[model samples]
Target chain A: MANLTTKIGNLTLKNPVITASGTFGYGEEYLDFLDINQLGGICVKGTTLHRREGNPYPRMAETPSGMLNAVGLQNKGVDYFINTIYPRLKVFETAFIVNVSGSTLEDYIETAEKINSLSSIPAIELNISCPNVKQGGMAFGVDKDMAAEVVKEVRKVYHKTLIVKLSPNVTDIISIAEAVEHEGADAVSLINTLLGMAIDAETQKPLLSTITGGLSGPCVKPIALRMVWQVAHAVKIPVVGMGGISNARDAIEFFLAGATAIEVGTANFIDPAVSLQVIQGIDDYLQRHHCESIIDIIGALKTA
Target chain B: MKKFIGNLVVSENIPLKNNHFLLKLTQAEPLPLMLPGQFVQLKIDDTPSVFLRRTFSINYVDRLKNEIWLLIQVVGDGTRSLSKNKTGDSLNLIYPLGNSFSMPTATQSRLLLIGGGVGVAPLLFLGAILAEKGFSPSFLIGARNVDGLIELEEFQKFGNVYVTTEDGSAGEIGFVTNHSILKNTFDKIYTCGPTPMMQAVTQFAENKSIDSEVSLENKMACGIGACLCCVTQTHQGNQCVCTDGPVFNTKELVWQI
Candidate 1:
């Protein structure tokens, strides 16, 4: 059997498959769909210091092969999750990562500190690249200076492995990846939803209540793959890639592109069991290729 | 694998006098255990342009034969596409989402059911429950015109049916609150529909100090509270409609309209 176990920075994952933040919510959402403990890990919904109401109506719109959303990091705040959600997640058998977001550098550090105190949550994915919220998230992610500052600040208080998620909306994504890498980030995840929109032609207005939202799904696979390959080569830390990856073929491509781990997004909206399928697909692919360990193919892309 | 258990096609998609339509979904799932005001997310496949599921309150659920009915209006491309689903076609559905209206408990007897526009869906089911329990209920259905009303005849058995239209094309002209039926107080009042209509009912209930519960319609994703899109202000603070409630006590809701 191929060894799927791998390390992201200082942390070790039993497998290379993970569910993207925001898309997977808490692992409980998929309990009826599949056994969450059987997978590598699940990145929970983005959490903050306080509860958020999110955006207004028509916050989501579907594009050509993807869907756009401006959910604005609506969560019950960290205190609620620690008190309410954390205990339940502890028993899931596998270590689960919590995806954290914030409105300011201080806000980011505060959330990281709070999460670090918990025992069950093994790591944190800094979602510095969400395009929907009005404040600190994508703002910090887009600029190399702020991204480094936020990561450095959070790193000081957070003892857990930190996976800084990068945004695709930037002009040069590799530069941002370098900044976070310099700030002591343990790993990096890329290609949060791309900024996109839809319009009601008859009304001559944007279809979404927010006018523009983040796009995800099969349409973004090619661009996301290119960015992941670029970042994987740019940073020494492992890169967790996600975008329009809906199946096993997509996951394997990311692994070959140098991604240490892959997150499955958008496909959760289509079918909740997609993460399980991706895991199974990777297992099947490994058997077919006669690979002994998944590490053998991590970044094994051949150059022409 | 979350296979498509059933693919219901649009059987009859006729525009009601109001912008809403009376849709008959073919290949629909045997109706699940849905109470009134509970809704289903319809994957309207008529157009490739809109892929997000459009949610509709389950107007009726017949579990024995396993069929569900929805009253949808052509509000947008997604909804417009829903109006195009016809007989023999498959429509993907995620059912019985959102919390249902609280059925009348031991303390309540007389139930006042109010509905506006396509909001009457769950109220009918509520009315049916009331009838089965031997409680006589009064129903007030509000629409833009008389033609907007659906399943009115079926409701006659549940209670005294009252209709209100904005253009004066039905039983009573003006808004649903314009009907004299609302003037009378009952043990408990239940409603669903446009914000203005529910707001008016809430106001009337508050003024009368009558305990009333209203089912709100908010745009949602994940319909299971995973996405915090469908939240409403309440005296207790903000609550997700998908989990906390699609149904809320009128007194608890912070009504804008």
Candidate 2:
């Protein structure tokens, strides 16, 4: 039987299919549909130092074959997650990666420090690249210096696998990925939602209350794959790819493009059972190809 | 984890002229404990091109007869397809999702139920719960016009019902807050509907220093709250409405934010 197990950085996952942050609130929400312990890892919702109230109403707008959202890193701060959610998540057998976000440098360090001390957490995905918010979200991610500086500061506090999540809203995503890697990000995941907008022709107004929102789902797969491939070639660290990955074939594409692990984001909106489907698909593909393990396809793409 | 739980077909698909439909599903299983203000995500395969499930609040549930009712507004392609479902066609459903309205306390003597637009379904269910517990509530329901008002003959058995239509063809012509019944003090207030309408009720309750709980209407994914798709701003911080609430106390909400 083909083995689906894979390792990204210091963490060993049963498979490379990890649920992206914001998409999977925590692992427990999908427990009824599937075993949370069965998959690779669960990246919890973005947590901040102080709880943020998020943005105004009409936070989400549906685009053709995709969705745009401005959820604004809305989370119950790090302390609340550690207090109310972490203990419950400890029961899941898979690795738990905490996705942390903050408006300031100190907030990032403090939140990272808090999660670093937790025994249940295996890694931290610093979400400095969220495109849906007006505050510190894409602000730190768009700039190479700010992105590296944020990663550098968190690197001091977080001893676990530091996976820097990169935003796709920049001019050149590879430069940002290199900057974070230069500052010591063990791994990187791209691309968080892409910046998008929708308009209500009748009202002559923007569909989302935020005017602009982060687009996800099938609409972002091509762009995300391109960035993943670019960053993988540019950086020495492991690259975890995500963006519009709804099916196993999508995951395989990322694997070929050079992502060590894959994350399912907006597809969660399509099917809560999607992650399981992707896992099975990978297994089937591997078996049919006579591959013993997933490592064979990690970066098999040939260069011209 | 999904079994062919049950298939519900369209029994009655009546359009309320308010862009909403009062759909009665015929084929359903024995419902588990469903509370007021809870919802069901429906799989309406009326047409082959349609994809994704449309969510509607459980307007009422008849557990004994094994029937479920939904008050759905034909807003998008999904709902348009649902409206076309014939009586014999089947529909897949995952239901009684999100947090229900807080049940009235035993010592509480009065229950005030507020509803706006399609948000009245759960309130009717709430009224049924109050009736079962022998607590009669005063219900204030709102809509844009007479076309928006849903027939409430069945609800009369559960509570005192009042209707507010923007066009004045019904019980009260003005807004729900303009009704005399809501002007008085009550032990508890429950509401669901348009955000602006709920915000108004919450503001009114705040002025009187009365306790009220509002059910939010936000886009959701995994209706169980995992998607973080249905998030709301609260006094504490950003919280998933699907998890932390679909029901929240009025006073506790940081509405201005």
Best by TM-score: 1
Q: What is the DockQ of each candidate?
A: 0.29, 0.33
TM-score of chain A of each: 0.98, 0.98
lDDT tens string, model 2, A119-163?
Answer: 989899999888776678789999999999999999988898999
Candidate of highest DockQ: 2
Q: For residues B91-111, write the lDDT of model 2, one tens digit per residue.
A: 777766777777767666788
Query: What are the TM values for chain B, all candidates?
Result: 0.87, 0.89
Docking quality level of the chain pair in candidate 2:
acceptable
What is the alpha-carbon interface RMSD for each candidate?
3.8, 3.7
Question: Where does candidate 2 clash, by residue pair?
Answer: none
